[model samples]
Target: MGYKLNIHDPQDPTSLPPSTRSRLASGRRASESIRVGIPLDYNIATLQPSVRNAWIRTLKALHANGHTLHPVRLPATQRALSAYYVLAPAEASSNLAKYDGVRFGSRAEGIDGTPESVLFAKTRGQGFGPEVQRRILLGAFSLSAQAIDNYFIQAQKVRRLVQQDFDKVFAKQNPLLDDIAETEGTGDKVDVLLCPTAPSTAPLLSKVEAQDPIQAYMNDVFTVPASLAGLPAISVPVPSATEDQNIENEEYTPFAGVGIQIIGQYGDDKLVLDYAKELQAVARDS
Candidate 1:
């Protein structure tokens, strides 16, 4: 969460642009007491036992540090995974269409016919990886006239719902919203939302390859929702000592440490960084 400028000049901070320097100075200060929302029912089934334990400990530490903790449920975030996959691929297909040998990206050698024929097919097949190709194809299908209403349009609606879910929980108003009516929700708004970064720790490469593609996408469940809402989010790692407390037993200890994600409202980037610094200290002590 904290970034030390690695430049040779120690006075680099002073040389920064006015806005950048102001943000840096603000981020360096400790955050005031603020309400943080913890989703009591979200992603419960998907999280690993160790990750759940670490997340709980992090929340306890924050509560002990005088930060108010509130329980909130964001059910719309559960649909973000599917919506993101559809929308992301559809956008990628449109953006990357130019990379078909005629424009940017690598071109294939000695292909017969026009750029739209064998050349395009061969170029994309050789240049793009299996996953990229899969997404591109899926995207193309989703955007097609026949499937647009069912897939692409539905995904767009889901994206809006996901954004609204975050906006509802955030105490700060989203500047992008036109009116105050957009922020209404059931519970008291919170300054930030805390959750696990992923369902579990980093997985082994072999295990990853052996799993189904859907299972692989499940790793992104916790992160995609924040992205859909365009919120400022940081994943701070829990200290190894705290995360590996059960090392003596044959339990699943996260060697790399679990990541606790803190997500703040849009334009709350500085606040997010400040909170992250405090959470990092809490993580070390816990």
Candidate 2:
């Protein structure tokens, strides 16, 4: 809430002179009360009770503020999560390839004059941690000649579907379209979509360590769809009503806040931030 900023386009040098820090130090609210969609059915089954309660409270706050809310579904969300795992690791594998001993990152010793393959392997093995290594290997496997079409190609298609699903819901058409729609904010479609940022509040460190890799990945279930679509999204923390005030003697206490996410269409970054500012105000006033 204390932040101030300005929007600048790097591609357009004219937009760069007014630095973000020089802008007026005040948050802007949406000029009009627009329809908001809440994907109530999106991954609700696996949502933690505390997170679910937090979402419900936020929903009530939004309704009380004179904004319209509706229930909508994006059928591709689950598929998008699977696609993200495939696509992200594949990208990481290719992008991180430059960090070999010869050019980037920390180089391993005792490998001077070795074959390029051995040098690269030793450097990556010594430099990358377990998670990065796993993703790199997964990406490499997905990009392999035999598997590229089956995994990477399919993931790309799913990513397209994720984008299309978002496009279908937002009232404002994606600016990337060849024929941009002239009329915006004038339809039955939602101006923004609201949902939980994660499936749960912060986890106990012990539980985090105990989670298997796939289980850990499931934590991103609610977030990856918007990411794959390249939409502008923000997560605002909403205080949970389930805090245990009497748990002072407990060895571990639950975190009392969960983030609720707001997602808007492509080129709608301003709209997303505007809505986020309003949501933050709602949270504070509550």
Candidate 3:
């Protein structure tokens, strides 16, 4: 393979996402980070108080370093988050159905049962953990003969709307589309989106174990919309505020740095990583 390059990374070089490698095929990393005001989406602001504080500080640092920051609102975030729960579990249920013992499931030999039906039940009962079992049931119910149209079909429609939301914001083309003529009509587009990675910092193991499993899913709130839209995103850790400067919250600790995420349009994974590196560099140098 004989090729020339404008930029390269040796540390985890070849493992780069395919989208990234192809972007570099243009023989350039990217244009300089612009002077445009970075948009801070409204949904991100409603995250845990500590996470928001971290974002505020990070933005302050950016402003201090001479970057304009703009605050914006995204109305589809709530709908998208709701739709992911439905779509992901529905897909998981269909995907996981292959685990029936005859072809692809763990045999639950420990259970004493005669008929094949009993074995199938035992295998599933014993093989899947509680949380996974719950999702499987929910997914099955959603896909059931009676509920398919009401739930699964509706969920699919929601998923497309979710994809449209990102397309308008990014302005970049979605590679999945064959014809770009019908793209979401005009609106402001951003080079990249900056937001918190989770609703809060990591929680203590004991607390996480004790809480309702569904509650834990909320932590993924800020990140799921992009995921549902099939966009590439990366989280970069920005230095935390000092004890005296930190916001006092029982859920957050001094050692927990803010997790800021960068998202780019589909097949724009390389650009997303570039922006994250730039933001992390600024944080480190500051």
User: Each candidate: what lDDT?
Assistant: 0.81, 0.80, 0.70
- Model 3: residue 230 alpha-carbon error in angstroms: 0.4
Q: What are the RMSDs of all candidates, in order?
A: 6.3, 5.4, 5.6
Rank list by lDDT: 1, 2, 3
Once fitted onto the true fold, the runs of candidate 3 whose alpha carbons sit more than 4 angstroms away are: 1-31, 35-41, 44-46, 63-70, 111-118, 178-187, 243-246
Q: Could you give candidate 1's per-residue lDDT for residues 87-118 as a string of tens digits? A: 99998899889997786887878853575575
Error of 1 at 149 (Å): 0.4
Q: Is candidate 1 or candidate 2 better by lDDT?
A: 1
Error of 1 at 145 (Å): 0.5
Q: lDDT tens digits, residues 1-286, model 2?
A: 6754456666776453454324323422587787889875574687877677678788889989999887777887879879999999999999999998678788778754355456467778888999999999999999999999999999999999888888877776675655554555555588899899988777778877877999889889989999999888999988766453342422235555788999988767778898899999998877
Q: What is the lDDT of residue 64 in candidate 2?
A: 91
TM-score of 2: 0.84
Identify the leading candidate in terms of TM-score. 2
In the range 1-286, model 3's lDDT, one tens digit per residue, is: 9776534446665454554545432312544543222434544554767667667776776667565555445556767667777778888899999997779966878653666565578788888999889889988888889998988788778778777767666656666665557555534555567777887777777778898867887777788888888778899997665642356566665566778887777767677777677788777875
- Model 2 misses residue 91 by how many Å? 0.8
